[model samples]
Target: MNDLGFTDEEIERYARHITLPQVGGIGQRKLINSKVLVIGAGGLGSPLLLYLAAAGVGTIGIIDDDKVELSNLQRQIIHTNDNIKIHKTDSAKKAILDINPNVNVITYKERFSFKNAEDIVSKFDIVADGSDNFGTRFLANDVCYLKNKTLVSAAILRFEGQISSYSAHKGSNCCYRCLWPEPPPKGLIASCGEAGVFGALAGSIGSIQAIEVLKEILGIGHSLNNYLVIFDTLSSEMRKVKINKDNNCKLCGSKPTITSITNHKDYR
Candidate 1:
């Protein structure tokens, strides 16, 4: 093995990454040793998992209960037509291995729930949230915050997408609740089924989310912790705005009200 402990095959596979002055042998080794848990295998999860696996993240855990549907194929590019009806985790695992067999993939064909969330989340070094609904989004964010794991969260609807990374473990920065105190009302909630997301928007936002996760693991470049990136495909405009951790933010605030996961009611 090389000094970085990379096998001959691994060295060749990650040559592009190792060539960068910003990410030499050390950063490549860091990437090969990182463990990341991605919350969904849908649109956003598709590109996130693909990129991370190709980047040589040593271990990746994917959780998704749904089966591959015809509707999912358009944006969830990780699954193929032959894999339709298969569990998303299984299909995703297959796709990730296809990209990089050296990267170990752990799959959970289950939904994120109070009983299992903490246990599942604690197993990974970081979490990338690509869940579609508000309930899962809030649940993932809250659990990551409570578990003190770095969280890279992203969402897309229609032609727009947004992403942010959060870590209350380091210092006072924004958690998902800081940007959104709680899930929206049932009547106000929107879905891709209703609003319709651009097919490419998921790739655009999810790919960046992958970058955020790598940056967090490598401790390179600026972190997106207190920043939110908004992308508008229709207008071809992108905006990055600063946010803050609400002292009253039920979850990570100074006077925190959401001391436990159950306290933040899931409106879904």
Candidate 2:
């Protein structure tokens, strides 16, 4: 164990990262000290949590009110058949600890909503949004923006996925609301359950989300802020589109209308 307090086991475990010029012992230590909050424990959260734990992220917080369902096994690899019917937060915490017992796992057996957003998000350095609904996505972006937390958010539906990081608090970067002013009309966009997501697609996108989160913690590589990445498995193509902050955007615009996070009255 050196002055950094890395046990011999930890040194060996993160040798690959410590050897990298971009992420030597310093970067590994940064990962060890950083805290991240994940907004779901389902498909995207499954791989995202696992990878974050394996990469030696010291503190992880998981929030999800739902229980593991049999259908979740198709993409939510963090849970086994034994975990079915268990709260997703509980199941994901178990999986994270199993991968890296040194990690501090905080489980919130509740949804990430306006009532709890500020209190919960304020505790973490970064947030990863893997939620499946537009409401949750929008709420997370808003709360993270208002709180000045970096948000790494991703979504998967059918064979397509989209991901971006938002740090609108920086003033120059665009928030999710900049790209999407509002949630689409009801019945306009189908849910993953309704549309049938490709199970492997979750792995692909979730892995990338994990990468972006790690990069943010280590302050390495290009940030996805002000940009959105769209992956199409069917076409085997990936597109990185620049997202400019909209002056008319209600949330992050010049004249911001949404100065606070509210329950989705408009979303309804």
Candidate 3:
């Protein structure tokens, strides 16, 4: 092993990354020492977890209170026929380990909610939010902002998907709440299940999420903190829209109302 502590096998495994000027030895090491938490193990989470582990993220935490259903197999590539009826977190962990045995996979067979938001979120350097519900998404944004962690969030419905990174805790960056002040009325937005998502759309968007997470870890290239990316599979088009921080936002505004998880809990 060299001074960076990369084994010969690791060097060989990540030779492509090491050869890149932007992500050389140091960047690969950064990736090998990073901790990332994925908030779901379904469509988006499936590909996101696989890419992260393959890229050598040191520790990965997966929290999902879901069972691997036959329907999930259509989009959740990380699971197989045998995984159906088992906990999604367990199935995902097995997949991650299969991809990279060196990765430390931590599985939480539970939902992401206010009760354990901070406790779980604070443990990771960054969070990838692939949750399908508004409650969990909002909670992740709030907790990530409160804990001063970078959050890369993505969602897919029908033939479209949207992704953005939130770092409002950092300079001039906007939090998720700035984009949608609060969760829409329960029945207003139909979920992927209800609306029927394009199976391949999840992989397309999830791969981008994985790229953003790596960029954040390596501190290389531009960050998506103030920009939102929307992808339309039907037209094969992708658009990046600029978003500005809202001063009146409850979470990250100057007169912020959400300073802690407790504040978020009370407001919710």
Per-residue error for 27 in candidate 2, Å, reads: 0.4
Off by over 4 Å in 3: 263-268
Judge candidate 2 against the unseen true structure and give its global Cα lDDT, from 0 to 1: 0.93
Q: Model 1 TM-score?
A: 0.97
What lDDT tens digits, residue by residue, belong to model 1 across residues 40-116?
99999999999999999999999999999998888999999999999999999999999999989999989887778
Which residue pairs collide, candidate 3? none
Error of 3 at 166 (Å): 0.6
Minimal lDDT window, size 10, model 1? 259-268
Alpha-carbon shift of residue 119 in model 1 (angstroms): 0.1
User: Candidate 2, residues 52-110: lDDT per residue as tens digits?
Assistant: 99999999999999999999999999999998999999989988888899999999999
**Winner of 1 and 2 under TM-score:** 2
The root-mean-square deviation over C-alpha atoms between each candidate and the true structure, in angstroms, is 1.2, 1.1, 1.4
TM-score of each: 0.97, 0.97, 0.97
The candidates, ranked best first by lDDT, are: 2, 3, 1
List residue ranges in candidate 2 displaced over 4 A: 266-268
